[model samples]
Target: MADDIVFDLLHSEIINYALEQTKTTNGSKEVDLSVVEYIGFAAGYKIMERLTREWPRFKDELDTMKFICTDFWTCIYKKQIDNLRTNHQGVYVLQDNAFRFLTNFSNGHQYLEYAPRYVAYTCGLIRGGLANLCINSIVTAEVQSMPSCKFHIHVQRT
Candidate 1:
């Protein structure tokens, strides 16, 4: 319990530091979270390598997504995805009723404007994790309410 709180605090601080660094460097009104996302991407790619070291090779794309929805999400967020939807056409949506990052904020839409900054890293994390698995994807997030968030994964077939 205490460890979780510490982790959350550290995560929040990292995001805040990244935002501060971006503001200082760019000196512009636009908030570019690409740096944060890229950091997440790199972290995800490396973490995935370690996480899957002892696991068997995935049989298909669906299997890989399952790993993300279950093991990967759980490993990082400490909870399994609440819902996962797919269109059989290379699109997958993973919903979390209580996203770890957002859960610390209000449950209402008070902080809606800042949700993007919070989710950017996670979006990159998902993308990076998939990339490490040899699956090219564009990961995006939709936050309707504060704590609940949905991540959309578009698998690129090339």
Candidate 2:
């Protein structure tokens, strides 16, 4: 419990600092977000590895992706995803009406512009988690407002 809190603090600080540095150095939000996503990727990969040890071996790629969207999402956010949609062709959308991390902030309109930073970290987490399952994919985050976020996962064609 205590460790989780500490890690959360550390994660927030690290992402913020990284974002600032990337913005100042390259002035690119995409790059800054990618750096943040990399952080998530590292964490997701490890967490998924550990999780796989206890979970049943998946027979379908879609099932594995759902596990990440539901079980993994809950583990990180304390709640399951609100909605999940898939095209059955490797495109998935996970929507969280009250994303836990974003819910903590009470920022008004100005916050929308900065929402991507937080969303990027989450996008990275999803991508990293999927990658560990041998499903190479790209994750992008869209925030319509505070506490509401959509994560788009596109599985790569190989």
Candidate 3:
């Protein structure tokens, strides 16, 4: 519980600060999202380094990604991912019905506007995790409402 709170606080502050900085710099939502994602990417790389040091090596690309969906997501959010789907063609979707960072987010009118920031951060985290495992991929996040987010991952088929 304490860790969860700290994570929430730090995530919120980072996102808010990034948005503010982006506004002053490029004033583009896309730019802000990129900035946040970059931060997540760095974090994801560090996390993967720490988590994988003692774990068994991944068997394949899918296994590494599955680790992100299950182990990585759980470690950060304190909950397993709600759903994982793949076409076995390098495309994957991981859904979380109650994503931690957005659980208490309730901006009502600004919900649509503000939700993307958090989602983008998550996308970066997933992308970074995959990248750390040597899987080049594009990850994206979409939200239908607060605490409900879907992450889409696309790995380059080797």
Candidate 4:
């Protein structure tokens, strides 16, 4: 309980710090969260290295995605993804009905505009984790409403 709150607070502070750095560096109204995302990417890559050290090799792409939706997510957010959808064509969607970061605030559309900032890190986290596993992908988050966020992963087949 208390640990979750502390984690949430730290995450919020990190986002705000990244946003401020971006604004200062760009010197304009433009919002660039690449730095924040990259931070997540590095973290995710390293974490994945540790997490998978003892695990068996994944059989397929779907197996990898399942690991992300369950173990990876649980390690970071303390909850397994609520749902995962795929087209079986190199695209996957991971949904969390009560996204940890967003749940700290309103449950509705009150902070919808700022949802992207909260999710940018997570987007990169997913991408980096996949990259570490040798899966090239672009991860993005969609927030149609508050507290519930969907992450779309597009695998780039080369």
Off by over 4 Å in 1: none
Better of 1 and 2 by TM-score: 1
- The candidate with the higher TM-score, 1 or 4, is 4
Q: TM-score-based ranking, best first?
A: 4, 1, 3, 2
Q: By TM-score, is 1 or 3 better?
A: 1
Per-residue CA lDDT of model 4 for 1-158, tens digit only, reads 89778978888899889889888888998888898899889988888999998889999999999999889899899999999999999999999999999988979999788899999999989988999999999999999988999999999998
Where is model 2 poorest over a 10-residue stretch in terms of lDDT? 101-110
lDDT of each: 0.91, 0.81, 0.80, 0.91
Clashing pairs in 1: none
Q: Model 2, 1-158: lDDT tens per residue?
A: 67667756776798879978887998765645667778888988888888778898898987887787678987888788888899999899999988766776744455787777677778888888888889999888888767788988899997
**CA-RMSD of model 3:** 2.2
lDDT of 3 by residue, 25-86 (tens): 87665545688898888888778889888879789877877788777887888888999899
lDDT of 1 by residue, 47-75 (tens): 99898988898998999999999999999
How does each model score on TM-score? 0.95, 0.87, 0.89, 0.96
**List of clashing residue pairs for candidate 3:** none
